[model samples]
Target: MTAVPQPTAALLDGTALARELTARTAESAAELRRRTGTAPCLATVLVGADPASVTYVRMKQNSCAKAGIESRHVALPAEISTAGLVDAVTALSEDPAVHGILLQHPVGAHIDERAAFEAIAPGKDVDGVTTASFAAMSFGLPGFVSCTPGGIMRLLDAYDVELSGRHAVVVGRSPILGKPAGMLLLARDATVTYCHSRTADLRAHLREADLVVAAVGRPRFIRGEDLKPGVVVVDAGYNEGNVGDVDFDSAAARASLITPVPGGVGPMTIAVLLEQTVEAAWRQLVS
Candidate 1:
C-alpha cells in the first residue's frame, strides 16, 4: 500500500496578510490626507454589464472605502466603441483627483482591449494593465504591479516562502496575471517557467515546480496528480463563486502549501490596489 504524502509546506493565508496590508493602507491614506489635504482616489471603469466585472469593481470600491480612499466609477454601454472606451480611460488618466485607475478587463470582444489598457498612464495604472506597467514589472522596477500577481508575491513573502533558486512554474501567460507573475518570481531569483494554452504536457512542468501558480481561468485545470509533493501553490484565477484554476481538494492534498480561492488571492488583490492608490497619491503630491 502506498502512503499518502504529508504536506511539508503550510497554507499561505492571504486573508490574514491582506488584513494587515489593509490596515497599513488605511493608515497611509490618513497620513496622505494630512500631508496633502486630500484623500487618495481610485477610478474604476467598467464597460458593458459583465456581472463578474461589476462585482469585482464593486469589491474594489468597497475596499477603497474601508481604507479611507475615495472611489469613482465609470460605467459604459456594451456597444460603446473602442475609441469611446479609450477616451474614458484616458480621461481618468488625466484626472488630477484620480490617483489610481482600474479598467476592468474583458471589456468586450468588439473593443480593443490593448488600446484601452494602454490609455492608462503608467503612474495611475494601479491595476497594472498598461504596457509601461508590464515592462516595469518585468524589469523588477518600482512601479504599480498587476493586483493579482502583486498579491501573490505579498502572500509568499508573508509566509516566508523562499523564492531564491527555487523552481517556479506558472500555468498561464495572460499579460495581466500569469506572464507578469512568472517575471516577478524570476526577479526574486526563482527559475521560472511559463506554461500557456500552447504548452505541451503541462503535468510534466508541474512535476518539476517547487512553486506553482495556477492563473488559468479554467476551474480545476491543475490536478493533484500533476503536482509534485510539497510544492507551493498560488491559485490566482477566480471563476464564479470564488473558484480557482486548481482543483483545491486534490491540489491541497499534494501541496505542502496552498492558497484557498475566495479568501486567498482575491482579498490580496484589493489590498494591493488600495495600497498602490495611496502610493500614487504620495507620488502625485511629491511631484
Candidate 2:
C-alpha cells in the first residue's frame, strides 16, 4: 500500500509580519523623536551605480521616511579608491546626527569590501556586516545583527517554531546571510550544519534538517523532493524575476511552513534595519 505524502505547508506571510513589525518600529521611532527632540538617523553609503543596489537603497530610504527616521544617502563613484570610500564612511561614523550606517554591498571588484565595511563604527553598523557584529551575533551578545538573518529569527519566533536541539541546515555561506544565520541558530541551541558551493551531498543534509534556510543566490535551486517531510523552509534568496533559492511550489507541498520570495524575507530585512536604527539612536543618547 502506498503511503500518504506530506500535506501542503502553511504560507508564512512575511508581508503581514513585516507590516506588523514595522508598525511597532514606527511607534518606537516616534517615541524616540518625542523624547530626544530629533528623529533617529540612518546613513546609507553606496559605492558605484549598480541599478539594483540603487533600488535597494531607495527602498530603505523610503522605509525610513515612513517610520519617521531620517535617512542620509551618500552615493560614491564606481571608480572610487578603497581608501577614499573608507574615508567617507568613517566620516559618517563620526557624524553626531547619524545613528546607523549601511554600506550597500558589492561596491566593485576593485574595492576592498571588508575595509569599507570596517570603516563604519560598530555602534553604527545597523546593517550588521562587520566582523564585530558577526562575533556578537555568534556569541549571542548585545549587538546589531545582520538585517536578513535578524529578520529570519523574528519570523521563526513569531510562528513559535521550536529551535532548541532542532537540526537546521543552512544552504549558503555568504558573510551577510548564510554564515550569520547558522551562527544565530547555533546560538539558540539548534544543531546547525552549513552547505555551500563545495558541498558534495546537499540533499543528504536537507533530508535531516528540521529547518532549512535557502540563501544561495540561484533561483529555485532547492526542490521539494530534497526536503524532509514537515521541514520548515525559509528562502532568503531574492533574485531577479522575484524568484527564490528554493522551488516554492514543490517545497511548500512538503514543508510545514515556508516563506515566499517577494513578500517574505525582503520586508523583514528592511524592518529590522529600521528598528535597529532607532535603538542605536536611543543607545547613543544614554551612552
Each prediction's TM-score versus the true structure? 0.95, 0.96
- Cα lDDT tens digits, model 1, 198-281, are 999888999999999998889888988998888999998878766889988788888988998788998898899899999999
- Give the C-alpha lDDT of model 2: 0.92
C-alpha local distance difference test of each model? 0.89, 0.92
User: What residue runs in model 2 are displaced by over 4 Å at the alpha carbon?
Assistant: 1-7
- After TM-score superposition, the amount by which residue 3's alpha carbon in candidate 1 deviates from its true location, in angstroms, is 11
Residue 13: error of model 2 in Å?
1.3
Error of 1 at 142 (Å): 2.6
Poorly placed runs, candidate 1 (over 4 Å)? 1-9
Cα distance off (Å), candidate 1, residue 225? 1.2
